[model samples]
Target: MVVWNNSDTMEPTFILRAFPGLEYVHSWLFIPFCLAYLLALSGNVTILSVIGTESSLHQPMYYFLSMLALTDLGMSLSTLPTMLAVLCLDAREIRASACYVQLFFIHTFTFLESSVLLAMAFDRFVAICHPLHYTTILTNSVTGKIGLACLLRSLGVVLPTPLLLRHYRYCHVNVLSHAFCLHQDVLKLSCSDARINSVYGLCIIIATVGMDSAFILLSYVLILKAVLGIASREERLKALNTCVSHICVVLIFFVPVIGVSMVHRFGKHLSPVVHILMADIYLLLPPVLNPIVYSVRTKQIRLGIVHKFGLRRRL
Candidate 1:
């Protein structure tokens, strides 16, 4: 089992165990990861640059896309570097402090990304449900505030998590279930009682992701109702088409976020390798897929990307 480097106190509050057969699986996983990492970065940067340079894209929808790209970049950075190191540099077992910081930012960025998605959903809701009033509803100042809210909301939820994690004392059993220092995984290593940690984690999930999902559903509910009343079949179909992309994004993100949380809490006996791999998938999957989804599903972003990349003759 991999051990934390913080052995100065002779008692570890954080436990991380080395798993068998991980090196093999770990080695093979990075191949796709490298490709995914490059693609995600390229796609996000292309979006940002294209939107920034093009005056026509200075609108609410593209503004949200720019923020999405930025958040995706952050999401990728949070896990990929350390992940790549683990595979390539033979570096395993991070320091407890390092682990806590990683936990904080990883949670923060993911939370922020979720908020960005929620904002995008609202954008579509307004644009489709009230086309004439879309600009007035989703103005530049409002978009900027929404972007800032993503950061604030993430930090607000994340700040308490590490503080809660720290109160526990490590007496015995410091082996973490997975590679990176995940909250629940790290909680499992605590020699002291972790009831509060578990409760707080659940509360945060309910408060943040659960809260966001609820609002998203409500937004779409209103959107659907409004669309249904519309006389133009073409307009209704167009609105629904826009929603399809957002729906795919929501499923891709929330499923794994909630899934990893459940597996960590309930399925303790699952292979450590599986635990690590799945957790990584949760972290990386959204980033890897975000750009692809946007490029293919979002016409504006796809045009922006193709034009900026000089892939074909400029129209």
Candidate 2:
């Protein structure tokens, strides 16, 4: 029942809600949100700097880590402007074109992160399971190709979403669920028939996130099998330890994603706060926690950090 007045000159502007039902508390939430942005920015930048400057750490693992840091940085930056505008300036208005641009980058970086994580999992599998052939398998050229492939795949898939949205004339209130533009959130506001959008969205999720998660799980299963074959308990522990940081990050990324997906599909009658919180967690937590997890769990990264900050002992 969409009232389609398709005029090219009449572009709709969207109102971004900081937190739909919790507008009164947005001021209080701003402090933590700002702090999280700062921490995520500083932490991921630090990881990149440490990896970039340290020659000893220029391996396939650190290369993938750098890619993860880049994605985290992109993800944080994609939402920072609108988030601040909504919370601080109360500037909730965003034009359709700008909104689509933001949506493209946010979704692009999101899928890119998943792709990088899958690449890292494969890196780990090779490092642990095929130690003798690790270098031959993940050479710098191959690694670059992998990174480029991830970027190209993400861009190609996400680019169509905004184009598809552009054709639809929106006649609803245009109130966004969170501080930023999301595909599903915006689609719901369209008065036009959205079956194609919905189906394409689901297809992207299944093709990208779903496939990546399944492959990551498969890589770990194979990794575990290889680890068990090691005769020495100490060797087995060392082998499994390498995957701990990646596992932590995977959980941080996927758990919130699952929560957001579930809420989107099943929790329509639920409070807006639940939906907002899940989106925030999915968008914010990985950037904030990924560096911390890597620094704490990866000894080389920890040492690189200490040395970078001149905190390493002279002894």
> Could you give candidate 1's per-residue lDDT for residues 33-92 as a string of tens digits?
788889888878877898898788899888887887888898888777667777666566
Worst 10 residues of 2 by lDDT: 1-10
- In model 1, residue pairs whose N, Cα or C atoms come closer than 3 Å (at least 3 residues apart or on different chains), thus clashing, are 1-18, 2-18, 13-170, 15-174, 15-175, 15-176, 16-174, 16-175, 16-176, 17-176
Estimate every model's Cα lDDT from 0 to 1. Answer: 0.78, 0.92
Q: Tell me the number of clashing residue pairs for each predicted model.
A: 10, 0
The number of the candidate with the highest TM-score is 2
Top candidate, metric lDDT: 2
RMSD of each: 2.7, 2.4
Q: What is the RMSD, in Å, between candidate 2 and the native fold over all Cα?
A: 2.4
Please write out the lDDT profile of model 2 over residues 207-311, one tens digit for every residue. 999999999999999999999999999999999998999999999999999988899899999998888888988999999999999988998999998898999
Worst lDDT run of 10 residues, candidate 1, spans 11-20
Candidate 2 residue 187 Cα shift, in angstroms, is 1.2
Stretches off by above 4 angstroms in model 1 are: 1-19, 261-270, 313-315
